[model samples]
Target: MAQRLLLRRFLASVISRKPPQGRWAPLISRALQTPPHSPGDLTVTSSQARPLYTTRVCSTTFNIQDGPPDFQDRVVNSETPVVVDFHAQWCGPCKILGPRLEKVVAKQHGKVVRAKVDIDDHTDLAIEYEVSAVPTVLAIKNGDVVDKFVGIKDEDPLEAFMKKLIA
Candidate 1:
């Protein structure tokens, strides 16, 4: 039953929707059709993967999906500064960074928003932002990309990063 559901999702993503166009259209299109194999490709698939971190921060943290419209509404249009985390389900470092990012965002007590973007589900976002790797965090303000970083960061750095964004 699970396998069938997974197949449905895969087909819907690939067949029903049209590919986004832009400078990265060709690359994104190719990637969608021929996704690269993960290190444990045989044992794990992107659909089967779940986030290792699950701490909630008072609706301040939300997942961004459905391409440009969603991102524009949640992140770009948000009154508060947005910390956009571009990560993949199968990424190891992302699992560690996600919770920590949430924790730091929560400290602000709604001053900032944490927007999680699954690179696999929103390749156009990743490509638009020039994200070449997983676990990239961007600080956005008033629909503009203000700051960004890649890879996992410790609590102290994460705190400082948030501070800078809000400041």
Candidate 2:
């Protein structure tokens, strides 16, 4: 209960760009920094009283294969659209396209999933999907291959390709 109140006060003060004035000001001010300050010393400034905690939301938009589970899970099993990245480690183009494709898929913000299938690691999947070349990207939805590109694509075109899938 107290922590919630303190957080609310802190956020409110941060948004308002003013100190949280009241009986709890001293406590809140002390929690904001090391070395407690007296009640009269309570002053909230962006630089002096910023959020001490930080975190990054883990990404679920890339790499979903280490075994024979197949594309059904990431495609048909999932109602959302998925981008299947068919590539091989030795392929020079695959190295460049992987991260670019990931960034494009990530821009969709959970609306899409990027499933990477390494041709060498999962040769069956590659052959089944007719991935004759490395860095062959296929957009799948409801178990159907919808769209694709055979090699590396620049940022704008890649984003457009993903945006079409979500739309």
Candidate 3:
């Protein structure tokens, strides 16, 4: 009971003190002066501006096995060069090489993008590209195949390959 009375007295004294007047006082007052709104009205804060996930978000690499049409759009028609990775689930070398290639490609920033295709999932693309083996990486530019390599490559080889593609 004593603590509660003391706290109340302290709060009352603090409340009686006026805040310092400044140039921002009018803006603060205006922001605090919210008018009546309907239930459908929406309010957004800077923290809630962007979504956690968005389709247009850029990434170093993405899967292209779902839609071949979109693959053509992203790779062939792209203004930037694209690296096409043809791999399969059962291919041991592919598992080792995919992430390494993505890491190397990321260093290029927006100069290049990677479109990964699972040979098992997209057999048509594999056959169309004449991919006879797994871990076949192709560098494409201006809708044409520029450079290619088959099998797993180490970090140095991968970096060199990406450098050639951007050049």
Candidate 4:
């Protein structure tokens, strides 16, 4: 009788040690039911489609207009010198220059402000500035156009010109 009692107690302990099958079984089954992510199922959001650096430049590029409609307030009125990049989407030279200027602008954010004008969109400003070509970069200081570059130029010269204006 004692042997039988001992066997029953051991069986009870073993059964108790095993989890209630229904409790976790459903959860595990549900977890496994989720389909694995496939390459074809992946979708890239705008924010995630580009790299961090590219996203940064795209965000920092500013748009500005020309003439007396608070142009000075936006650019020249600022404490820092302004570098305006006149460009269009279709211009290859503008495309190359845009990124280079963006890097420079980012590096000199506090000291200088970088602005971009889309000539195609802002034709009045383009005509006022006599922007005959795309990628015309102008350095404005104290409400006056101080230095201008008609084409893609090295960052060193641009930086040097901006430093002089800011100084």
TM-score, per-candidate, Cα-based: 0.65, 0.65, 0.65, 0.59
The sequence of per-residue lDDT tens digits that candidate 1 reaches over residues 5-105 is: 45534544454246557797776555445345567544334465443445663788998868889999888888899999999889999999999998899
Error of 3 at 42 (Å): 31
Residue pairs with colliding backbones in model 1 are: none
- Report the lDDT of model 1 for residue 141: 88
Is candidate 3 or 4 superior in lDDT?
A: 3
Residue-level lDDT of model 4, residues 41-91, one tens digit each, is: 543222332222223333445677555464657876866678888899999
lDDT scores of the candidates, listed in order: 0.82, 0.75, 0.78, 0.70
Residue-level lDDT tens digits of model 2 in 1-167: 44644564566455455775889888766655534557765444445445546668756455656545646665557788888888877999989988888777777878888888888888888888898888899988877888988988999999889888888
Off by over 4 Å in 1: 1-57
Clashes of each: 0, 0, 0, 0
Candidate 3 worst ten-residue window by lDDT? 45-54
> How far is 25's C-alpha from truth in model 1 (Å)?
64
Off by over 4 Å in 3: 1-58
Cα RMSD to the true fold for all candidates: 18.2, 6.7, 11.7, 16.9
Query: How well does candidate 2 match the true structure, expressed as C-alpha RMSD?
Result: 6.7
